[model samples]
Target: MKILLVEDEIEMKDSILQYLEMEKYLVEYASDFNLAMQKIHLYEYDCILIDIMIPHGTGLDLIQEIKKIRPKTGIIIISAKNSLDDKIDGLNLGADDYLPKPFYLPELNARIKALMRRNNYEGTSSIVFNEIEIIPEERKVLIHNTLVNLTTKEYDLLEYFLVNKDRVIQKNALVEHLWGDNADQFDNFDFIYNHVKNLRKKLLELQCNDYIKSIYGIGYSFKTIL
Candidate 1:
């Protein structure tokens, strides 16, 4: 899943980014409110972790703007302010959940998973697309009751496709979802092609039909319904 962390504290932000990345989430960050605003307006995230205290504006205000832009995106208020009123106000403003400061990364990850399950995956721990079964919590994939070994990137790529099944996902968007906001650091999308090829080969070896479709110069689509 894609996550945007809006935090001003350098150490906390870095720690969250590192932990989430290791957990196979595409994470991006904005240290200040202005940067946060720019990012929220530009891209959509599966979940957003916002710190109420930041430069320029209160993270509380950003929640409303984010809701207006992407109502389906999950919101979590992660702030040092643990006052009852603050929590109440945040939830009242349509935030999905709240995490206080000095929290463990694993707990935060758990929260994100819960939120994604609630909002995107219909509160399920597993995603089943035809004969393919994916248990996100366990990071396991099985086809025809047989496990299919996939590299980390390959698994993430497949998850992305399943989440956005049947939609034409642009190459750059796919890169961004996998590599986070810094995908521009790469000059080309050849890495994506290679990963897709490997994933297809692995699935085909398991007697799975080809579900990924190339969209000419645009990108590819996961034709799950076919």
Candidate 2:
């Protein structure tokens, strides 16, 4: 999943980035409130981790703004401040969870997973669509009870398609969702075409139905009969 981390401490930011990346999440970070605002406005994220004590603006303000712009996005407050009022204020401002500093990385990871489950997957550990089953935590995809090996990018692409099934997803949206800030480095969406083609080929090889359909001039859709 894609994550946006808004933090100021260099050591803490680096540590969280490294840990989340190791866990196979696409994470982009901002050191202060302004940069965080820019990121939130420009790209979409599955979840956002914000620190209360940020430069120029507070995390509470960020939460309020996020609720206005991206209300469906999952949010968690991570700060050194552990006051009851701080926690209350954050929750009142629509923060879903709070993690006080000096917290364990595993705990943080668990919180993110739980939040994503609640927000996107209806709190389920596995996503099931027809013959395809995906266990997000394990990054495993099974087709008709048979394991389907997929590259990291291929797996990510499949998950994205599943999440937005039955909806037309633009190629630019795919690039932004997968590549984040680095998406600007690509001049065209040929890379997206290549990835989707590979993923489609893999699923077809497993005798799975072709759910992905190209939309001519627009993009593609993961069409489901139901």
Candidates' C-alpha lDDT: 0.89, 0.93
Consecutive 10-residue window with the lowest summed lDDT within model 2: 217-226
Clashes of each: 0, 0
lDDT of 1 by residue, 121-165 (tens): 789999887889898888889999899999988998898899899
Residue-level lDDT of model 2, residues 83-185, one tens digit each, is 9999999999999999999999999999999998887789999899999999999999999989999999899989999999999999989998888899999
Per-candidate TM equals: 0.93, 0.98
- In angstroms, the error of model 2 at 134 is 0.5
| Residue-level lDDT for 66 in candidate 2 | 95
Show model 1 residue runs off by greater than 4 Å: none
